[model samples]
Target: MTAVPEEQPAWRQRAVERSTRAAKLRAEQRVQRFLDAAQELIAEKRTTDFTVQEVVDRSKQSLRSFYQHFDGKHELLLALFEDALSKSAAEIRETAGSQSDPLQALRLAVEMLFEQSLSNPGVERPLFSDFALQLLVKHPAQVATAHLPLHQVFTELVEQAEDAGVIPAGKPRRQASILMQTVMFVAQGNGVPAGSHAAAVSAEEVWQFCLGGLSGVPVRN
Candidate 1:
């Protein structure tokens, strides 16, 4: 046999490495596909009877592949919660940071949250599928963890406003907790009951309500 060139072996090695990398990438994609499919189903229908097999079928991935990525349905649900929190937190940071005025930033942040709740009604549906409801019913720790980022951002903004003499300095944590609670109450469809349908509040309404409660006036225009 003719001697194989060194470059040929090196090229084969690179090809093998690439194939391994592609496998890993595909694995990651499958994991995300499952998560996306689960969220879509949960968003469209009820999560009361959702199952891992359902997710696998929706994602077009094998059940074995699903287990390779997640421990079980509970684990997958927790992952979904964490993913939602991460996405919401990132959006909050970006929207809030873009506003120079602290109060306006806070309002915008709240509005963005309201919009998200509306868009993902199944996830945030006041009586249907409260984000906090599931956590309170199944996993309190997850709910507590989810509040951390919201609390942090709210506390920071409150403290900053205090420093600027925009709002009276007091207990930031207490204030943030109250704000979160109020938002949840509104999101949970507790504001009022409409005929056959529940009252759906808009982001502007939430922003105004929060502003009023905090004694914060919307920045001019």
Candidate 2:
């Protein structure tokens, strides 16, 4: 509890600041290295194809350091997918919440879907395609896995529409499912040529189409 001195030396203060900054920079660099390694490995093959050691080597970091940032491979892959979903959800939440009209909210939600697909190409390739297929096909038990928080956001949007009388009063879950399928189809509709209409279609176009379906004349409510 004794004070070291009335005033610290300038050089010592500078050294302390430099050390703190360096530590922060190192942490940031390590995260980037980890993500870069993940992207490189995922590009080459599926999730099952890569190991912790391979990721560390690709990152040019020690295995111990990799463990410092992540508990294990499962944790890392979950983190990667969750991060992408979180970003997309933020945009969707903002778009959906800010709009007064239910149709606008639906449009924004759809737009968020396409935007997420485009922004995170690396994730879209694995999670939306292969990982999703594997979880549904090879591992039915896995399909019952915890609902991604992002999906909850989508469900909430459906609930809002139902309350607003934009959608049918009953079967909110079914309505949400239909909307989810439409978004998924458009987002995962790859393989089309660049010049084609669907290929050229913007996120806005997807949003408009979805909004039309949700708000069609004969209100189901």
Candidate 3:
């Protein structure tokens, strides 16, 4: 009947929609796999030394799927760098918020952030590598956007500490940014760097030693 044809078209459209959703879901999963594989390789090697074929194999996804998700390894590395920076910055804010005092919170925030460098970035890697750094630097606005959350936390804490007479009055955000950058580079990847010197130096030890220079006066624990 004519009525049956109209109903059949609606049914077909629904089926097509369902099929499209399933395909999209599969593509996203494949993308995640590729990202994980790339992260593993980059962390261990400190460079994009691995090949696209290797990442595709590790992801258990086909080369076509890999290309669909990323144009190439450079794009994948950029995603990872942006992701890691934003993720770590958010964590620092959360951790720093839990401290009793602004100074203490700042220290905790710094120590926790310092863990990010623990990925063992030797001279070869040196944080995002020159190639990746150059790419990220080109997108300064994006980089700053990713860092804004952590910067805001620092700015707020600096204001609080200054108002409470905990720290000297100065450019709170600028000072905070400098401090955060210093601590972030202290460790290698995302935790405290491991070594004889690092082993002997506890996070608290580092904090106490630098307190005088940081506070310009003795700070109580």
Candidate 4:
């Protein structure tokens, strides 16, 4: 018969648990450092062409730590992208939630999105140019997952609008999706040439077009 192992004391067990928790916290800090370094490089270079080694160097973390946390560069980028969009979704939701009118809430959300895309070209440019497009093409499912938070916010606004009779009684979620796509298309024009007509489009114009579509009215110039 195999010998029975001795049980750990309660105090010892509690100490072990505390050690594990501390280790997990440190690991999370290391992961965040890697992410922050990668974001800094992307902003500085205005592209996502940098390497994992570069991120490691910038983060002051080891290669082993990065690999331990992430599979590789693509995985890191995906994490960073998800984190960013999630934060943006939260901010937009908060802002929209403050508005009394559903239509105004929706408009404010769209305007904020457009403004972010334009104002923070350093981060937004690389995100939209490389990571987002690549994910859309190769990992459409991941794209949908990453975009879910923002989509949900829009859907909620659309539902509110429909309930308030500001929009027609139809598929609110589908309408929200269409509106999101429309806004993103126009916002992505931030990557266009500075003097081009596409680049000339403003957030107000985008909002006006979306409002017109939502209300079934022709947009006036």
lDDT of each: 0.72, 0.67, 0.68, 0.83
Weakest lDDT window of 10 consecutive positions for candidate 3: 121-130
Candidate 4 residues lying further than 4 Å off, grouped into runs, are 1-13, 119-126, 190-199
As for TM-score, the candidate ahead, 1 or 4, is: 4
lDDT of 2: 0.67
Candidate 4 per-residue lDDT, tens place, 29-109, comes to: 999999889889988987788999999999998999899999899889888878877888999999999999998999999
**Residue 107 accuracy (lDDT) in model 4:** 93
Per-residue lDDT of candidate 2, residues 8-60 (tens digit) = 89999999999999999999889778877877787666444688998899989
Tell me how far the alpha carbon of residue 16 in candidate 3 is from the true structure, in angstroms, after superposition: 10
Q: Which scores better on TM-score, 2 or 3?
A: 3
TM-score: model 3 vs. ground truth = 0.65
Instruction: Rate residue 16 of model 1 by lDDT.
Output: 97
Error of 1 at 126 (Å): 12
lDDT of 2 at 37: 85
- TM-score for every candidate vs. truth? 0.71, 0.59, 0.65, 0.86
Predicted structure 4: lDDT: 0.83
